[model samples]
Target chain A: MTPDQILTPILDWLDLAGVAVFALTGALVAARLNQTFVTMAFFALVTGVGGGTVRDLLIGAPVFWMQDPWVASVCFGVALIAWFTPQRWWEGDGIEYADAAGLAAYAVLGSAKAFAFGVALVPAAVMGVVTGCVGGIIRDLVAGRPSIIMRPELYVTAAAFGATLCVIGLSLRIEQTVVWSVAALAGFTLRAAAIRFGWA
Target chain B: MTPDQILTPILDWLDLAGVAVFALTGALVAARLNQTFVTMAFFALVTGVGGGTVRDLLIGAPVFWMQDPWVASVCFGVALIAWFTPQRWWEGDGIEYADAAGLAAYAVLGSAKAFAFGVALVPAAVMGVVTGCVGGIIRDLVAGRPSIIMRPELYVTAAAFGATLCVIGLSLRIEQTVVWSVAALAGFTLRAAAIRFGWA
Candidate 1:
């Protein structure tokens, strides 16, 4: 089936790449908390896909990771890099900007998947929110730190706005690349704004 | 009709109490991470019901938390407690033991629910493990910490052992209380042992 025809995209390539990016974000955060290498890998894997798994389960879709090996494999690779070079990747690395990028990626990916699964508009929007937020939610709870949801930051709001716009665009059958680009930009803009203004 | 006669457990007060206990553990852990009130509540809700949600999805049972508002209410209560008395409840006194107790309660609760949903031995065992571990996994990732699953720790092992004993007792036609006692004790013992011996 064409990628357009697929509901839950096994984004043969982007999915793998997405996993690496999200895992890197997860691993870097865990490293900052002083976790062991094994712990870092676990966090990366869980954070990278936690939201997607929940969305899949809610929609009665096959759990995404169980359907493919690449998700786990990519996370492993990301973890190895993080463990070997935390200082290079995490410390003094404009991490806030990196995290903002990761958030934008997560928002777009989550929105796209939920829409594909035949979730209703509101629920799809919710799923997108969940997908973007849940991994960090899990990470913070385990690390015993404040999570994004608790902070008045723009994290979830940014994701929601992007997801809503994406859903609206898809409903109107707008061009896919155009819809994605707009959503991604909106997410980035909101996150950047929050960070710059030191919004709570 | 017996408790298992109807698949939905809406009237089961024990289940409500069970969710409260589950949320308590989540809240306690979140509090340790210094999460804000909202994050603590969200964590509590997810932690309390996360295992069952995963079990239901895998086994084709209805996700219990979505159908019940009591679980959410209970989690709110736990979050309130954790937030209002963060130091006392999560850090000030005897919090480690509280954590152990929470682990024991959830392990048994998860296993019994799995059995009631007609899961077989291995899947039920897996469900037990999932229930015990997933909330903590999410908690760690969101907190920017490493998850327990990646650790050489005894957490999953202990939960599995407890779940196994619970299943065994059920097969042997033991009393519910007897089985629960056995399972909770087994879980607590293993966890305590791990904490004491520094086992991963």
Candidate 2:
């Protein structure tokens, strides 16, 4: 099979996985704020789908969440999980690790999708960063907190690294599966290090 | 002529007018924050196009600003105006009045476009409010300020009034010109009154 054919199925799972993790973070934020179930669900939904929605819009594609019934269901289900679980369960660096993983995967997925949609290489990479970061930014903004971007974190930088690597790999006609895996790993490693070592 | 045909030409003008006024408000906000010229321009562009961009994305339309050459030009030009002019020039209720006008016109145009794109009635009205308010919401969020939605203003209510009216008129087969004019005027009147009388 061609690279795209092989990557398509994997991308689907990655998309759902990223959405669930992001949604969990969103719900957790609401839970910490003592918000109601409805508010938590809303937060989950927006955080899960915000980045992909922006990417789709910029690429002139149908919105990913609106088209997929399963996406909103996943967000709500994640919210329900967050609502019932004790905050201690999600404490420590676990969620941050998961977030880093999601950021890397999402960045790769975003750039890959953009490239597939005929976007130029640089813009495709930028789309990757946007897809990974915009959701959290939106979540923070609506919650009236300082957004992640305002912090001197390497959050966006990690996403951009993966996204840019993916685009470059695609342009070099590398195998899609290898490119995605390597790029995501590289990004995750960087982000994980940042979280673990307090890298700015 | 069909309502759409008659409204099309007028909608174009309304769109630009709305963009210019909203951009001014956005730039003004950045200026108040003592941001750089670049920040002011960025604020202007986002505030001017944020609502329409969201509307187009939701309705599966090509983003209006991306397709239009003049839209970004208009936003940047307005930013320049805000940058060079004294702050006192934009002080008082003048900008608020202009903002009210833009809000109403934009709401009408947003719903009209959504309706044309075959979105259903209530959702179309929601689109109008989104188009009218999201830009400012984004601006506030990025500026790390409490968003206007947090206030008890009649801002969104007025936009909804205009948007819902436009859709209802369209559904009832009212003349396009009359529908747009009446809807815009109704919204502007309410907003103006709120500004003048300090109505919440």
Candidate 3:
């Protein structure tokens, strides 16, 4: 298969998965805050798509969510789920694992897309880190909490590692599927380790 | 004179003035935090261009700072000034008055640009408010402070009123210069009054 044929389906799935996971987190924040349903949905939408939106704008691409009909619907659906469910239902390591997976996928996707947009290698990697972390940062900001960036966490570092790897792999003309898979898995492993060991 | 002819020059000046004032505020925030020069410069650039950047991205216009040569330079210069000056140099109501004026001008400019981009009336007005307020919102977020939006202040309200007036006037086919001037003056007056009387 051509690189496009291999990467397209994977990227599409990654994009949706990332948005859904982030949206759930956003809605959970609002629910914890005792905000209205509207607020929950708004938070879901912003957090779900915030990073991708920033990446697209920076790379001068048409905004991904604006063009994709399903993204907003997914965010709304996630918000509804969060609203109807108790907060305790989501209390566990499950959400963190999902978020870690999403983060890695998003980092890989962001770097790949940026490289395709003709961004320089370093910036493409930066875009990857941004795509992974900015949504959470924005969520904290709008929710009036300290940004995750201010915390001594391995979150951004894991994303940066994945993004840099993706950029490097692509620059080396590696097989697209292998590069993406390896980059994402490596990042997810790092994040999972961080979570399991309570790494700062 | 053509609407474009009259409005362009005014908008240009407004854009620069708004950017400079906001940049100063951003740099000042960093200075107070005792951050490094790089952080202050980053804060200044983001605050100076944050609102306009969002507006442009939403409206599918080219990101203004990326296109303009002078904007980054101006932000750097403002950061440098803040770096060298005493905190008390920015004390009192002088910066507040300047910020108020900048807020009004930015509101008018944002709405006009959004309308010109063919966004509908209400959203165009929202774009105005976004343009005037988002920079500070971002600054506060990055600085780990409660957003000014959470405060019971007249700040956003004044911007909204001005944006609404600009949109209404443009829709009514009033003279462009008159619409812009009246809109900006009305907003500035509200903000100034709020500052003077400590209006919540």
Candidate 4:
């Protein structure tokens, strides 16, 4: 397959992974609310898709989901899983791991999309910041907690660091895969460590 | 008064009124969630402030709340009222009116801010739509419901009409109070009429 063909599928997977992880966090929050299964699924779907939609609209791009139905499909599929699965799987002690994954995945995807759109480095980084945190911000606000903006563990800062690194790596002509892997790792690691140590 | 003095107080009152109205809705939602009064207040403050913060950041302006404490103060005052008042006042009897007020106030402020930032007509309209809708969008997401985006309604369309009128009024050299009064009236009228009659 040509490079153009390869790029589309790779980007799709990254976006899908981001959506799935966000869905998990949404489902978890809904469960915490003791919401019904349908509500849980709906929350997960919105949380999964919300950030990217905002990003596309801001950048004047056709909304990604409207163009490629796969993104919505992934969210729908995750909602089904979250609905049908036994509560124990999500509610178990390992929930933090899933939260960390969601954070990292969305951050990197946000940065990548910005880079793809040729946004300036700073604005791109801000896009990454918004993408990574806004969903969770919305989640916590409705759930009636102080937003992560009020938290001390450097949530947006971590996303910024990873996004900057990815952008720099791309500018320096590094391999795309390597840049994304490193960026995602950076975000995931910071979140994982923070959760483990109760840093926030 | 010079432009700075004249505009500052005007912007402040708009922000205050908008914040209070949005805060009322947030607090009302929290009350419905069976959250404690403190939680309700916190949601009120966040929802009242979140859209403005996001809008400022997007437009490369100082976030209005951080620059002035009065916005937060008004939000708290509104939250107190929301909390101390009887639940039935909001839960059934007054929610529609409060929501209509919110929809109007925020939409006008958002559009005005966009024009102040020198955004063009299309982007400005986009700003108005986002300004009017995003607060509720964020609030509903956090509260876990189908947001404006998912709803079949004239929510955005109403904001568009009001925002467009504001821009056109400005272009035609309409007086400032006249401009905002018309915009707010248009937004409220559109929203209330639609909600009351189940008009889409």
Candidate 5:
């Protein structure tokens, strides 16, 4: 099998995993605001797919969620979970760590997809950052809160680092698995440290 | 010339007109909030292109702004205009009237594009509404204000009227110019009336 054939399934699974976690955060935010279930679902759907949609558009690919029923189902399932769970169940650094995992995985996935679509490396890295951050921006906007971008968190930068590393590793013909794993780990480390230390 | 060839330039022109107005509103909002020039430009670019960007993504078209420099230039120009103008210059119903005009034109343009792309009629109309209103939604979100969609107004309804009418007319094989003009007129009238009467 070609390298692409081998990598595609793994990337697809990673994409869905990232979507589920991001959708959870979106629904959790809506629950915190006491929004209705409909709102929660909308938040989940948009947050889960928003970044990928933008990435696909920029790369001239079909929007991913529209092509796959599974993506939307994952978002809806996660939304239901967040809606049914007690808010206290999600309180702590655990959710933040999960979000960091999603961010790093998504950043790598976004860059990899862009490169597969023949995007230049730099723009692909930028697409990675966009994919990781845009969903939260949309969620905050809909929820009428100050967006995460407005905060001085190291969120976007972490995604950028992961994406850039992935792009560089791929360009150097590194093993795909090792490149992705290391890149995601680097991003997660930065984010986890930020959360633990309350870094601006 | 083919029908598409004949229509492309006209539609492009209308798209730019819509972008200019939406960008102006975005920049004006930033100005009202006393934001810097950079914020004004960011707001203008995002608001001006946000709706059409969504439409293009959903339909699998190349993102419009990235393919055309004129769109971004117009957005920047409008932002500069808003930034330099005195606050009083944009006061009263004039900007509202301009926004109404843009809403009508963009709604028709968005629906027409969707139809041309072979989207189903109902989804095409919905695309029109999305194209006309999403820019302001993003602008409001970035500015940390309640979006127009949440307000008690005829805003989205007006865009829907124009989009639905355009789709129905095209489906019935009406002349393109007449269909678009009539649809835009209907939307403008509704929005204008809403602005004048403060309709919810």
Candidate 6:
């Protein structure tokens, strides 16, 4: 199969999974703030799709969410769930681990997309980091918290590592699965360590 | 001259003026926060270009600042100026009036740019307001202040009025200068009134 044919389903599933996790985090922030359902939905949509929107725009592609009605529907669903559920259910380390997973997937996906769009490697790596972190940054800003990027953390650095690995793999013509898995694993490992050990 | 030819230089001047003033405000916010010169420059560049970057991305235009080196240079210049200036110099209402001018100009410019990109009238008008307000929103978020949008003021309303006027004039095929001047004046007048009289 052509590389596009082989990778399409894999990337699609990764994108949806990443978006769903990010949307949940956004809704949780709204719940923590005691905001209305409308605010929760708004936050979910923005946080889920904000990074990809920035990446696509910077790469001169159409905004991805605009083309997919399902993206908004999923955000709405996440908002509803958060509104109905107890906040305590989502209050522990589980959300942080899930967010790390989403971050890694998004960073890899963003780098791949930028590369596919003919961007240079450095900027593509930057796009990857942006796609992973911008959503959380927007979430924090709207929720009136200090930006995650401003805090001494491994978050952006983990994303950068993932993006750079993806770019390098692609440039070296490595097999797609190995490339994606390794990059995402590296990012997730670093982020999880940061969360678990309270690493600055 | 063709319309593009006629408006290019005029719009260019307005764009530079708006960006410079917004950059100054961003740098001032950094200074107020006791941030370093690097942080001040980063804030200035983001605030100076944030709104137009959003508008361009949403409208599928190339991101504006990336194409122009001078934009970053101007932001750097403004940051240096802010870093050197005393806090007392920027206190009180002078910066407020300058911000008002930038807001009006950005609103008009954003509306015109969106219209030129063939966005529908309502969305174009919305883009105008987004362009005018988003920079300040970003600056506030970075500075840890409540967003100006959350305040009870005529700020966004003034931008809406300007954008609406610009859209109407464009639909009527009015002279470019007339459309731009009237729309900007309407926005500036409202904002100035709000600042002077504490209008809600």
lDDT of 3 by residue, A1-200 (tens): 64445556667778899999999999998888877665676578778988988998899876676435577678879999999988999989999999999899999999998988889999999999999999999898788887889998899999999999999999999998899999999999999999999999
- Candidate 2 residue lDDT tens string, A1-200: 64356556777788899999999999999999999999999999999989988887887866777767799999999999998989999999999999999999999999998788777665677679879988998999899887776566778779978998999999999998899999999999999999999987
**Model 1 misplaced regions, further than 4 Å:** A1-12, A196-200, B1-132, B135-197
Question: Could you give the TM-score of chain B for each candidate, in order?
Answer: 0.80, 0.95, 0.95, 0.88, 0.96, 0.95
Error of 3 at A10 (Å): 5.3
Error of 1 at A31 (Å): 2.4
Per-residue lDDT of B1-200 in model 2, one digit per residue for the tens? 65456556777788899999999999998898776665676678779988888888888776666545577678879989999999999999999999999999999999998888789999999999999999999888888877989989999999999999999998999987899899999999999999999999
How does each model score on TM-score?
A: 0.57, 0.61, 0.61, 0.55, 0.63, 0.63
Q: Mark the 10 consecutive residues where model 6 chain B has the least summed lDDT.
A: B1-10
DockQ in order: 0.12, 0.14, 0.13, 0.04, 0.17, 0.15
- lDDT digits (tens) for residues B1-200 of candidate 6: 54446556776678788999999999888787766665676578778878887887788766665445466678879989898889899899999999999999999999998888789999999999989999889888767888899999999999999999999999899997899999999999999999999999
lDDT of each: 0.71, 0.87, 0.87, 0.72, 0.86, 0.85
> Between 3 and 4, whose lDDT is larger?
3
The sequence of per-residue lDDT tens digits that candidate 5 reaches over residues A1-200 is 64357656887798899999899899999898999998999999899888888787787866777867799999999889888889999989898999999999999999888777766665667678778888988888778788776566778778878998998999899988899999999989998898999986
In order, the interface RMSDs are 6.9, 4.9, 5.1, 10.5, 4.7, 4.5
Off by over 4 Å in 3: A1-13, A36-39, A69-73, A142-144, B1-50, B62-129, B142-145, B148-200
Greater-DockQ candidate between 3 and 6: 6
When summed lDDT is taken over every stretch of 10 residues in candidate 5 chain A, the lowest stretch is A1-10
Residue A112 alpha-carbon offset, candidate 1, angstroms: 2.7
Error of 3 at B72 (Å): 14
The best candidate by DockQ is 5
Per residue, candidate 3 scores C-alpha lDDT tens digits across B1-200 of: 64446555666677888999999989988998999999999999999999999988877877777867888999999999999989899989999999999899999999998787666676677678889989998899889887766565788888988998999999999998899999999999999999999987
Quote the lDDT for A175 in model 1: 84
Q: Write the per-residue lDDT of candidate 5 for residues B1-200, one digit (tens) a residue.
A: 64457667998899999999999888888787766665676678778989998998887566676546488678878888888879899988898999999999999999998898889999999999999999999788777788999998999999999999999999999999999999999999999999999998
For the predicted complex of model 2, DockQ is 0.14
Model 6: residues with Cα > 4 Å off, grouped in runs = A1-10, A20-50, A57-98, A118-126, A137-200, B1-17, B27-46, B53-98, B118-127, B138-144, B150-200
Candidate no. 5 TM-score: 0.63
- Candidate 1 residue-wise lDDT, A50-72, digit = tens: 77677677766656665353676
Model 6 chain A: ten consecutive residues of lowest lDDT: A1-10
